[model samples]
Target: MAYEGKGVWCVGEVRHGDLSPSLFELITAGRIIADARSETLTAVLIGKGVAAKADEVAARGADKILVLEHDALDQLVDEAHTGALTAAAGTEKPRTLLFSASVYGRSVAPRVAVALGGAVASDASALTVTDGKLTLERSAFGSAVISTVAVNAADGPEVVTTAPMAFERSGTSETKAEVTQAAVDPASWTQNTEFVSFSADESKEIDLGGAEKIVSGGRGLGNADNFSLIRDLAKSLGAAVGASRAVVDSGWIPYKHQVGLTGRQVRPRLYVACGISGQIQHLAGMKSSDVIVAINTDADCPMMKLATYSVKGDLTQIIPAIVSEIDKVRGSSNGS
Candidate 1:
């Protein structure tokens, strides 16, 4: 395997005012691949005056910073951003393209790959490079087994979208590298959608990823009212609250808090499931958790079978008792 002159490019993510956290996370992970291949890790920051953010990326171990500065790129319109990224990728000719599996990255990676005549693996849990080939591991069959795939592409870069929580952030020394600025014309872009407004909830929400403790409730929570107990327990433990697909579909909780095959995939340190049946689909989303605790009435439930700890009882009574215990612990911590 004659492997030389390989470049790894990570798509820079930006929100309204500053760089996104996930972009840093990706850079941290991309550095590993870059070091493994003995190649440079470049970051593409696309937006007007985005070049100024190169210093921040440099702090995160980017060897080269490619800034696509354009007035039209100021706003993250999928079409414009994708076009600019595709154009930049064409010019750079990286061997591998890494992107965060975020809202923006999900929208852009596939389109850019298509434009570059490359192959894309989305939402991959693991990525490895060997012998000049990239192998992507992704969950399949309701998250029971992962299918490892080697993307075969004859031209352009191989695109890979990594789950936000798939890999821990790389701890590498920063490298001061050259910054290249490319301004793409928006008129040349094929715009199918227009930006209407960017008004969204500005409040910071708890990120399920990287959460040290998580408390999730399933359909067995009984009613929407019973979720309060779960919430109480989560608040006491300073943990994020999650719900199974059934509970979300039943409108017991918002879809954002759902954890299942079709919902947000989580890899928390401690996952506490109350009343969740532990279906394979549900299991797929959380099986990677470091520790699992199930509180269900049925002893034979699939989740209880795989749990590190199980408590069989009525959740209506059990959840409240757990919440009380957590509250007591918090009170002691606060000198109450």
Candidate 2:
């Protein structure tokens, strides 16, 4: 397939004046695809006063950086951001454009694709350049199945939004990319949407999407009150609390903590499942975790089979003991 664009591009995201951590992961994935196609890995950074952070993106893996700056971009107005990104894409004409599968990315990427008359794939878990064709792997049917799709290169540039924790974050490099400032006229673009005040989630705990360690509860937890055990264990380990779909559907916990195909997909370093039967939907969200520990009474549960460590017991008793042991370990370390 003959490609229309010159190189691979990653759309960088910023939060609180810092580059989004997901940018590095996208860069890491982009590097592989760029190298395979013998093209440069470029990144588009858009935000007011973000020029200073251009080096950060370069250190990760970008071979070049396009910095789009404007006071309007300081706060994320979807129309302004999408317009700027669309302009950058028009100028760069990249063969493949990557966006993080985040709330910001999901809202912006599709609009950019529409403006460029290009194809887009959302929630892509894997990417590859096969025989010069860009093939993306995404979860479908509630993550019970993996679907491999090849984009039509002849159409135009291919835009894709990658799932969270889909790829490892790229390491830093001594080499810095050449940064260029893109000219964008915010006034020229028609924006019906206005930027309003932003309010964050009320929960102070770690969000499930980016947590390194997660302690999750399931239907086997018996009732909503038993979630205390999950929280206690999470607090002891300094981990986030997560929940299976059944638990959330049953109103034992809020949907924010739910982890499954229908909920948030997480790839934590360590995932501890208490009383989870390991339904297929649940496994789809967390099977990518580095280590899985399952505590369940049933030994034949799917989660037990997939877990790196399996403990057979009652979670009410098991979780408290684990939390106690963790506290003792922490206390001893602190005392020393």
How many residue pairs collide in each prediction?
0, 0
Residue 245 shift from truth in candidate 2, angstroms: 2.7
Determine the C-alpha RMSD for candidate 2 after optimal superposition of all C-alphas: 2.5
Backbone steric clashes in candidate 1, count:
0
Provide the RMSD of all predictions against the true structure, rounded to 1 decimal: 3.3, 2.5
TM-score of 2: 0.90
Question: Residue by residue across 197-230, what tens digits does model 1's lDDT show?
Answer: 8776553546675476889998898889989888
Query: Which parts of model 1 have CA positions greater than 4 angstroms off?
Result: 1-5, 48-56, 172-180, 202-204, 207-213, 320-336
Cα lDDT tens digits for candidate 2, 210-271: 68899999988899899999999999888999999888989988898999888888889999
TM-score, one value per model: 0.86, 0.90
User: Cα lDDT for residue 122, model 2?
Assistant: 87
